[model samples]
Target: MRGTIQNRDEFLSKVAGQLGQRSFTEGVERPKWKYQPQHAVLKDAGSDELLEILKMQCTKIHTDFFVSGKSGLMETLKTVVSNYGGGPILTWKDSRFDTIGLTPLFKQIWPEENVEINEWESSRGEENIELAEKANVGITISDITLAESGTAVLFSSKDRGRTVSFLPAKSVILIPKSTIVPRMTQATKIMREKVKNGEHVASCINFITGPSNSADIESRLVVGVHGPTKATYIVIEDL
Candidate 1:
């Protein structure tokens, strides 16, 4: 009964009478909008074009962007990790890391054996938060890549914790070229389709534009206020 309407025709009949209508009915057609400029922006751009847009937006948001093939992604990831001072790395428990062939080098990605790596595990509960807070670098796979704002959309679930992206000082995000879309318009459409098709969409969808910054303290801007101070995005071409 959670999703069921309590009243059948009684409530609708009263409302219809007030509106001077005959009867209330289900499945009313949605009205088409007259001005739809949302669809006009970046209309049907190719993935390459979208990537270029993403790169350009990254400059304003203070994020680094890189393009790499499947073979080179591992090395690219390693370079990002090294740039962040050789973690204490935290990542999601995602199988795509194995599918994209990063699993093989999981142990030896970093040349230094002293580097510690951790994965977010739902089984661990609040223990995951502590690791994320202490981690130097946190890595995550982008659920959707918004080309317009250079945003990485993260779908949080049992295996993927939200804290992994925010608690860390630095974050490295892996984005598949195939997942890139024109903007929020396309991004929301995809999520709507997922719900229409009865897909299990995660409740918490994160639209992280870049390293967190705010101009609230003064008119002057301050970076790394609430979230990551520095962020890097690795675009996997052959995902």
Candidate 2:
């Protein structure tokens, strides 16, 4: 284990050397752009005003509603798709759950179209690319993302894949209001503390503000270019 750590450190140092000087040091000049969450207007907002602020800023609302981490997010997703009329594509962390649990949801949501409920254990190479192109919207239950920035952090693990957040026409997130924080720097501090205590850092860390958008085409705004055009966050309060 010690030798492995040494090798990893050496590899990082070599890569840093090749990359040249790093600019992120104390008391440095500011960069050209900063990521700010589109100002939102969360309904019934309180101490954390981010949700409300985001709601005000965005043009559309898309999200997975859940009461808790164990909430039936997939079922609620079915409800949205069924009522709204979007094609249903179900992906789960558990192969068995996909086999047993998803059938009823699909039957209820997509009674007309031939539903495609696919199971994937690993998201690598071609599979990742395919999932990105095929899925119009992706749903996820997250630990905590900064409400201020309108970002959702998914612990890249076996069950919750990173691509689920990126590479979709829309990305809808489910997060309890209690987990919402005021700023990204605070969240970073918390993550660093967790890492010091041996918490598993997922392969990717994402800070999403709005839909995948670009305005370069004749200065005309367009969404869903590199990623989903819209991101909706659902906040469930304790009732």
Candidate 3:
């Protein structure tokens, strides 16, 4: 016969101690992937081809375009946005990107928008949600991302919040085309590797395909949920 445990702390501590024993720590000092790198097969197009796609997608004439914390995005976005009458460009000062000295690059492109930086980040939830909902464009970075599927992976946590990507009407993504894999199978393999390496996985992983859409209510296609309606991926060349 076993005695009943009355103290909650003792029970929790016993369980936690047992669980901590199998804590993963081996092979925790490597990039998420080593053996099978993502396969990025470029689909070459004419010089104006990219522009034509943008037009066909109905990119707004004077709309905000969110820029993610990715390599080459700063320079490319400056060139691209300047050509199209730049609007708001979004970014995070996360260590993952800033440690690589990418923050300064972003500062160079469209510095005017920084006039209200503190106000933007410190805004209340209702205001933030409203901004996300009303804004026409958004951008995001990726981790353990996929290019073949034209998908961008974003983990909403801490400073890198979810509303930045979801509430917007249209969202754009910047990904290193080299990180594009052929299938989900390969993607998961890399994820497993990251875990084995003792990397801290994000609390929430957002796999954005094209954009936010639904066919609810008599099959009437409706874009924009509590999320974006149109989403596009601008695959950046691997440096």
Model 3 global lDDT (CA atoms, 0 to 1): 0.52
Local accuracy of candidate 1 as per-residue lDDT tens digits, 101-185: 8875565655346778888999999999999999999999998999999999999999999999999889999999999999999
Query: 1-239, model 2: which lDDT tens digit per residue?
Result: 22334576567667777899443325756475565433233323564466554444343323333332324545665555544346435343643334334445544545555655443347454675476568766656556756545666666666656777777666666566666765566577679888989987766766666667677859877767787766666555541
User: Could you list the CA RMSD of all candidates, in the order they appear?
Assistant: 3.4, 7.8, 10.1
Badly placed stretches (over 4 Å) of model 2 are: 1-50, 57-76, 90-114, 123-125, 217-219
Please tell me which model should have the higher TM-score, number 1 or number 2.
1
Write candidate 3's Cα lDDT for 1-239 as tens digits: 44666886666667768888533335546575755433332245332453344333334322223323455565665555444334444444356445444556455423545421211253355665555555545556665444334455776665666766776555656554445554455577777888999987776778766666667769876666556555555555443
lDDT for 239 (candidate 2): 16
Order candidates by lDDT, high to low: 1, 2, 3
Candidate 3 residues lying further than 4 Å off, grouped into runs, are 1-75, 79-86, 95-105, 113-136, 216-220
Best by lDDT: 1
Model 3 clash pairs?
A: 28-197, 224-229
